[model samples]
Target: ELEHFEMHAEEPSYWPIIAYPKAWSPSAKGTGEVIYLQIYGEEDLEQYKGKLKGKFVLIDTIRNVSPPFEAKASRHDVESLFEMATAGQPTPRPRRRNRAGGFNLNKAIWTMLEEEKPIAVLDRSYKGDLGTVFVSGARTAEGRARDSAKVVIPQATLSVEHFNRIHRMTLKGETVKLSMDLKSSYTNEDGMEHNIIAEIPGTDLKDEVVMFGAHIDSWHTGTGATDNGAGSSVMMEVARILLKTIEETGIQPRRTLRLALWTGEEQGLYGSRNYVGDFFADFGDSGYTPQEMKPENENVSAYYNLDNGTGKIRGVYLQGNDAVRPIFREWLDPFEDMGAQTLTLRNTGGTDHLPFDGVGIPGFQFIQDPMAYFSRTHHSNMDNWDHLSGEDLSQAATIIASFVWNTSQRDEKLPRKKSQEEELEEKREAKKASKAFKAVDPAGSWSYEVEIPGMQVTGDMVIAKNGDKFDLTLTSDYAPDEKEVIEGVQIVDNAMKFDYQSEAQGMLIDIKMNLDFSEKSIEGMMTAGTFGSFPVKGKRNSM
Candidate 1:
């Protein structure tokens, strides 16, 4: 599991060197224990062997912050959020889930590259808070943003106070004797970011594709041990096992299997999204609107994303696809003993798969135990090689490998639910015809025609105008305004809660339940919202 991007924790190291004239003078050879070298190009690290020369370069930029492990472990914020989501009583909390305010490290470097076009970057990872420097970004709400971040950038490091000596010396009358020893860095894996990609070609349906991925890039601060360092390794391991097993078993997938180790995942799912967008666009996914992107090819299977912190696999999120339950049930049969057995039809987001789901493509994010990830490691200073769990990772890799294998070998493609955006628009249009749609209460005097799920999450809500009354009946779960108690309306607040209710006034009879009103939320504080009914029975005279 730790084999892909092998975790390496770098112990603290302190080194020293001296500067020289033209960086070659013998007098300056042993002058000092510390040397401040300036880089001259995107690939050149200015290294002087003996003396001082041209420009005195400012070098190093890195930060380190520790984790409040004990404090975080006691807090169950994440636990509450996940549990509430699974039970369908979505939280009312406003979660930002945003990265630190931007334009700092990534931007400053990119901007400097754009303007100065330096040979290379000099960076020093900060260990504690005493040595501090804050950088800002180039964007605000008003300006037209620049889009020059097209490639992966490179970086190097030095000590802050040691490097500052050159800055002070050059500012004085001293022409700061400095030298740079630069080597060609962009020659190999040391320079550019590589996305490891592999694919299992489909046999029966060769046109379809099922992609799986995780980011591989991490801050140089601590070898990126966690905070996605583990994610990258896990995905690789998953790929390895699946490929090996497929080869050993001689099993060919029905859909193409592509695995990608994304770049700039920490910055955002840049690599994965760009890849998906470009791939689908090239093959014509045909996303005319921002919400719906269906390729002309029906063979394209769903995309599976695994990016939760490294913990034992608990279950796989369905991403609101109730239709996927049976399929997942079948696929999970093999790994039921591994403990990844639960499948909930709840929507979970915040990762690469979000982009796909936003565009109407079926995407799934697996649920995993967080373990001590949030409390102690993750992106903190403590996140190092030793933070990873072998057994947990192995368990995860096994499940993911099997999942990818099964998905790739599926005979038909996964189905995508209607985009929420389109559904919302349809709902808005349905409201205009107030008189056309009516709500009839089954208990009051309405007739029952069909049966549906015990809890109706949502559906068409129509209240028809009939003189003094509103005729209403829902095709799904429903609730009405309880406090005001409209002349003929029934409210389903905690005290007067009712899962099933019917209303009939003269010939019109209808039965419906409010989608928002659930038996689960019997104690929580809730504010009132407007309600609607549908006209079913002959209640035209009663209205």
Candidate 2:
């Protein structure tokens, strides 16, 4: 049962087309010689632009392969889970600035494809080996492929081995001819899709609802079994078990149990966001910023989600809602034997839970074992039923069923975080009650010592005040002649923080410093990303 026959080519035969059901792609059938464009000069692009018409274009360079040396599957250990449970506020990294200047070669190539109208553009997968290709949506020259007005040239991603073979043959001056037919059709022409929602009516609190769901949509490369199909199966199994428990025990929930199978979740959470906007929040022109809260917004207790592959529930990510720590601890107690014990305040993104959490409702996603989800499956051709674990799915369903039951019978709804209006009001009140204070003058030379992993480093930090702003100059003992000047130094109260970037021994170093200022000394920590944090001590030098 093929949804649509994507391609039928020569030796390196089949490759999945990169387009969704609603995205635009041509139903093309053609046979043409494969050509690899090698544009070295401005005139070369023009020469190849005229020759690309009715050809299978090799658009990517050959990929380098590496052996898999590490284990792909892993479970959460005690140390790692403990770190997650006690993690503090994350330090912000400097925003990356694109430094590329001059002619854009990649854009020029795509523009040529759009103009010449090639039979199909071919590229290799970014990751994966041994014929496991990852595939996703298509792209047009100007706008998005999902935009109906954009002209999307046919495109597909091949396995790295096949793509490299074709590329090498062409590089060796051998002609490669390919015959392909892509049979793709568009459905739901009006651009309408739906989400499946069912509910079990509560006995006493019929209006109040407790929801559980998983996105049913996935990438078309494989069956989407591990990425989200596992979650969907677990949710359905939870529903079945709940219905049986109710029938046998003759007990009804205090709040309605609602299950949602959302569509268009892979496409920026369209189904869940729209449902929340329609029922709970009044999203104005931006379609995401909530301008007004509706009446039914208060009825939703929480939304529990599972979509991280077929791994047993280890615990839960609290998503920064500290109020639910004790409540979740009690709920997770019954499942300690099933390995669901840990609880963390860390927030996980990229799922249907985001919409519910965005609008001030409590939304949570469970912590699961990472059994080859990122290494092999997860939107790749290997994300099929064969990779799913039945035992893991069963454990997840049992834990989720108990969680939903406990939520349904709670005396009150789960506590919510501070809303935008409440937070804004607090800021206003605090501002009105505060007095102005100036930072202590740190405008002199200081002797600095940083205890890094291997050794202690000594440096001199000179801060010079120019009217209203201060500039920092640092000279390390390791590089006495190389003085690094840093700008945008921020000093608030008795603390100072800044990021210093430098090059040492052919490697780039980025160190973030958080220093506490005193009358005669400074103490702090310098955190180099991935290299971990180190202690720093400094003494003010007598002028």
Candidate 3:
């Protein structure tokens, strides 16, 4: 008989803990002195060098958090749904700030903490004000995991109320103590991780595959429910539904329906990238460019992925492939009532589908509603089964299953846009066109005048070209003592940019000029350092 261990407390009593070496256990129990390590910089650790050993350390300050009274879970509202269907812009990602200083400081702090050997590290939960303790992986001293080297530590999180109490008690000169017994075990003896793959094989096109996948691995906190557990569940249910359909309807797909549950996605799309590299294309040394494409690259029809959260499918991101717009529109027609009608040319990144897309495969991620994935559940301790919407998951599974079925049963493989090589060539040609300006007239001299705040300066410029590179020499009344010449300039379209220095009022001033050429006139801006920029216009001097 299986035994169940349950906690019967009003507040959350069974808080989660992360420890190193997974097999290690702390059996000691009793109240001991707790130390709050408010070390943000590397030098701060020197003050508490010997104080952290044998004492629980509070690493973060207690923050004030409130219960989420607002609706944290919701499907797409009508207005938002309409906007999603019609909007042409991609979901704007938040700009990332440079964290090199913070990262180095943290690295130093962890290293010093490991050397100091604290009894345990405690942090306040980021969310869950009342009793929710969102937890994640413990920090290794060297900052990352290594095969042979594991900097083990016992780490835990406390609710905001409990953590604040301890923090306040310490601030008031009252001694705070804690008792902890943390045990964990590590296993990966074979040094292998696998992605779960199952398929409904096709009779005529058994070799060609249409893949639908979601990342299975997630943060240790909160059972990874909304972060990816919802996606995993939906993809699994899709597999089951497809199997039943095949069994009942007696219609096997023309192309194979392969379900892939990927791992290490949160760790930078490792599983899917490895899969693509192994079978489809070689990512090579750069990790972005495809160097060698394997034979299996042509065998894939498309890869569909879902990982945005527990939101139902609203539409699809076409990843800039306009050729498939009409085709997807036709497919989405039947599911208009289910709200899966949008098809945008924008690209959505940061998931497992990118690897396939990188190799020119028709890979896509569905458009989904926000649904508190960003504000609450994603990567937080609050990410659990309760946050998942059953209706949304069922709808997602149904839509994705139909998409997979349609792709598999299509008479031809899904249409692909230009390959990476062709796209790169087009970009190179456009760049060439942008850099090579048309010679409007044969090499000649043009007279121009610059209008400044206090002065109008006249200048004559001689233009010459050698192959595609252009050169210019200017003599202006503002700086008649010095001649400014620029060489080896490439004109983008009809515009050319060059830098020159002139002696003005006993000061050597640096100036940047942009020249635009037409059949009858030459116009430009002369930007002198600190003095300001002035408009310069010229006409071709008649010989």
Candidate 4:
């Protein structure tokens, strides 16, 4: 029996409406004259607070849509795949300085909308053209759109063509009127979700496990076919193939094979991260800050993930685990003819496997062919069953199944890179060994001089230790009467980093300081907003 699935707006006699409602948008209906407002800052938002009531407000400018010159779909050629296979460590880019005011325009717009109570808000899709409008969740001033206490107004992303038409009509003094009835509701009010986990018990090494899975959730605009449905389906197919193989051969795997279908990956890998924290490690606050590892950490060999799209498996991204290159190469030898031989030491992010990799377990994501996943389907209304390739998914399942089987049959657990905790301990020991030669502490008042483009300014900084944190205060001689208190200061080894706001010439400036300390002197750079970095040096004051 065919049942109705979730869809956007239904066909009705509404005034020229073809756009879809954003996910998590509340049910609402209204007919009003369209109002175009482009807010840049807080001042602009304040000016339009009382003017937007009961109007369908257009909140963005007309986007430029160029004709597609390049092909919409392509696979990684041999040269590109070879480049990935031979890729070395990526050079770290310089840190970007924060904007002057650090003001968030998008958040401000949503906050103003909530306060002004617009009949409906509309913006053009950030990407795509023709009739494809990429849609995501609604936004609130605070908390997520799904939060029970958060108020989510009716919002929809209009197609670029329609948006531009409306924008042009508004510019010509023509009254453009649109009526929309966005019918939506909250189904999961309790806000509870789960990760589906299952395992095939092993014979001799049942305690040890090899895991494989993908994220099962996707944005609501489409059926989520290419964004993640492809991955979820492939993993499920792998489970069926492995189960049937076991039933036919009567041979049990040496290590337990676990299959996990993770939820909430699109919302920042919450499901996988929580699972890892619960079973393997104690992630104190974030994935990088692991308090301790559980005994179960030793039993997991590796985790394999696939969430790129319907692209066939071209190779594997080693994710900086060089030790597995030879092992994986041997495993891929049979599939080399099928275009799955390359292995790179680089890392691929934005997926569910990251949680396992963060905790030092050997985790891997396959290198798949790029087939319109990013250009047309990913997070867009086109991410449906039609965009998926059956042949590509089959190839992916075959390669992943073999990789999982090979891992389960291995005699030892996959080799691991050094964990952050272990590296920190090593660095601490090295610091202690070298402390006798040059000892320094950053807990004193220091007089510093900074050399800007055309002038030099002197300042006094006072740093005090308050338990585990440090307190910093700065006063420049140029403005001797004013003092700036610095918050969220972090001191690692003999280096200090912090940010603070400074008022100069009636404008608020955001500044960041990175200072390194010697026995009795400090040296580093002070980065002022827009003006760039300046050299800074200081001497410790006598006690």
Candidate 5:
């Protein structure tokens, strides 16, 4: 079974303790009941809370061996085993550098809890060819599990040779002695962390809000210089540049602008989500309107994200929402000449933006060049200051600052598309049918057809079962009654083009045109993704 890792919105930074699962071994007394083991909980919750620790207790914390200079067998170096098998050489095979082989430690802890069994766990450190030993996030592992266990989240780092010695000795029915001491105390200050928040209030619309930020915390084993320290500083630089722009340009934005340096973002989206939602009670479900769900109306005036280290942002991810592609393209235009002007229509939704996207907000994440994100850095021990590049960091900050500047100065509240009422209604109906609630689609699940002089309008649109069909039909009134490939915007009038974008057979999402015609240009400046029904005067005519 695959291991499951659950993520939550609010997580703590500097947790000092982590409870990760280490292994599964023979049930105690060799009962063969299949036992699961892990480390969990504060060092002494009983001492702090003054209770029986709610049926759970833990002792010890991550014990670091020498600074990971060397260690034992590694599973990833399978070539050694292969060479041994093929060449018939008495070779030293790499150790299986794993957390007790691929067991769902979280699920095991939960199962034992239901069975009312008390348990103790041992989290060990592994040495590898990487030459660095780092403590695991075992406390975090335990917190994520939603289970109770007498978890002893302690570790003793050993050389690959030392670890193999233990394993090999055990395989030979020899016992190895391991004495451990892990201790700690809890106080209100135990979980307190920091968030770096900065703001530029709008002159005209100080009440409305627009903001951006990245996490400030990072793994302590290293300087956290890259894991997030770089992200935080770049965001900070964005704040500085925004302030400089406002100070020099004196163009007070009409909306409040804020920069948030998040804590625990390494664990989850804690800070940003809270800010957007703090005023939740003051508002209702500000949901997407039908227009918002259309192909070209995903609303998000602007949001910039950069997490691929300090690498220069080669492009912006479209997040599968093409509506904003042209806008981003224009924004990148100035920088493209500087080698940063690419806009990819690809979706990226893994980091902090996830929390915002979950709440129906139009969230965006950037695509940066993969400069050693995996070969080095990331969550590994090598994630430190020396791995950073000044040129990349500077470019990222410049772009982020520019993005925020434009968004803050935009004319109206950012464009937002409404989710389709029809789709929502259909979902409700499906739920009703499954529960036998006597709900059905009276429209009979098909489209209605109407013929125009030049084209045939497929009926009330229908969603395909396999999600692959959208084509416009041509009628004989203007041409032969044959399906014409839906050439985009065939009929252009008054700077406007209306076409039935057939995204599937018998399904059509209509395009009622109204694009941003930048004041001094024609055609290319058109923000077709910015949907509305307004007309613009152009060289062709006025719509």
Candidate 6:
């Protein structure tokens, strides 16, 4: 029974505000003149739809946050843990710029600011500076559910020096006012969300297990302490030091240690992928793609995870198995004096041990000490708890409680490597020679030729279909006055991605193909943005 909220903004002495109500806003209580929508289409929403119904808007554009002159936190020295233990095989980071058309144009400008009835809706605080107010959520435009949002409007964020002093005092004609009350609510319970389990039982492998977890849901601005309450307080202090070392040496665990804690893990790894598809392995929704397995997936044996934050442990990420590098280098040789020696065979994707390494198990994560967790507490609002670090969370709960007491007193179980149908049939024969160019029979038209060493490349493509979408056109003499049409064409598993853009000499280019079909040809690879990747082939034009 612990859920509550309260907000009451009305301070007007000429500056010093902070706001952040928005979780389902609507308890409104107004005061106007803080408007600032700057420019949101349809002729600026019809010249600011009758000056925004009562106004306090200021939707965005004031981001100038600063003042972290380095050293927000530190650790991992020793030449950055010997360059993350001899780096190599890590590349794959660049792809986070598809803000789905600026998040559907900020949900169509928050549904035209609730049909132009704004009296609250400020923003600014993409990261604190000055008065620190990095809050989150509130702007429904069909993202509903905060108890099913009917028509929310009251939003808030402020603090980037009070949103650049009320946006430079409304671009110098100054009027500012702003009042605000902003209440919030939503918790009719039974939305059932739990995952705090805990255990130890295991003399003679009490039904074999060994788990360990972290994400205890966070991100209401600060107090998510290092984006995860420092990995849920170091996995609840390694389950209270394994229940005080099994009550001072009366010994116990031979398998079942458990621990869990997770809860929607920042909404993606949804509570450990629904507790690994409700008890170890299913991948039904094609999530981490497994398919099926359960029987508690062969009774588990390894899971270990610890989100990266208060930075300590420094060695693990064996996600590409490699036979668990000599069983995690004999559990990091007793924590090489607490710096926990390195190991990496790469593959460290975002948390919750990727649904138990996407189902084949033997999951892991460790490798900490990146202090400043991506510079100043992830999901910043300075993830408070004074940026935790009790000696790096007691050296990550004493090296994850001795790697969960050596995988619950191992006697065999932790070595799994390939077998999710042989790693999806070795990723379908390393992508079956790019399938051939997937689909393209919307009545026919295709032909290609290439030589590129100074040109001799010809092309033609047409593939149409409207009722269920798929359109492409591509006549080329290498940019013959660029006409490039390539809308949402997909095919999956036979392959055929899409993306296009062109211009040349004045620069714009940006291609990206990927075909692969067959019955009469079509090959792949195109890329082209930074000007690289070519090899394309085609033929099939006799309808």
Best by TM-score: 4
Stretches off by above 4 angstroms in model 2 are 1-24, 38-44, 89-108, 419-543
Q: Model 3, range 423-525, lDDT digits (tens) per residue?
A: 4345445645775534464257889987652247898888787567766667777545335566667765565667755543223345667666676687656
Worst 10 residues of 3 by lDDT: 1-10
Q: lDDT tens string, model 4, 226-273?
A: 979999999999998899889999988999999999998876677888
Q: Which digits, one per residue and each the tens of the lDDT, describe model 5 over residues 166-193?
A: 4444445543333222232222234555
For residues 152-239, what per-residue lDDT tens digits would candidate 6 score against the true structure?
Answer: 7767676677778778877887666866655555564456678788887888877989889888888765678877878888888898
What TM-score do all the candidates reach, one by one?
0.49, 0.74, 0.69, 0.76, 0.51, 0.32
- For TM-score, candidate 2 versus 3, the one ahead is 2
lDDT accuracy of residue 517 in candidate 4: 76
Q: What C-alpha lDDT does candidate 6 achieve relative to the native structure? A: 0.68
Per-residue lDDT tens digits of candidate 2, residues 99-182? 111124444666778999988887776667777777766655444566655677887777787778788989998777776667
When sorted by lDDT, best at the front, the candidate numbers are 4, 2, 3, 6, 1, 5
* lDDT of each residue in 1-543, candidate 1, tens digit only: 011111111112223422111100111111112223444343332234223222223444223345534433321245543563365311111111111212123233344443432222333333212222111112212221222322222223333444454445544535433234432112223434456788877777767787777777654334566657677788888878977887898877777787877775554455666565655533234221233234632445677776656676767767566677788878888876776677765555446665566455687777777665644554444567886778878988888887777777666678776644344344434643455443333223211221111122232323343344334433322312111111233432211122222221101111222222222221211111101121111221221
Q: What is the lDDT of residue 404 in candidate 6?
A: 91
RMSD of each: 18.3, 10.0, 15.5, 10.4, 20.7, 20.3
Number of the predicted model whose lDDT against the real structure is largest: 4
- In candidate 5, how many Å is residue 232 off? 0.5
Q: By the lDDT metric, which is better: model 2 or model 6?
A: 2
Ranking by TM-score: 4, 2, 3, 5, 1, 6
Residue 181 accuracy (lDDT) in model 1: 45
Residue 12 displacement in candidate 1 (angstroms): 25
lDDT of 4: 0.76
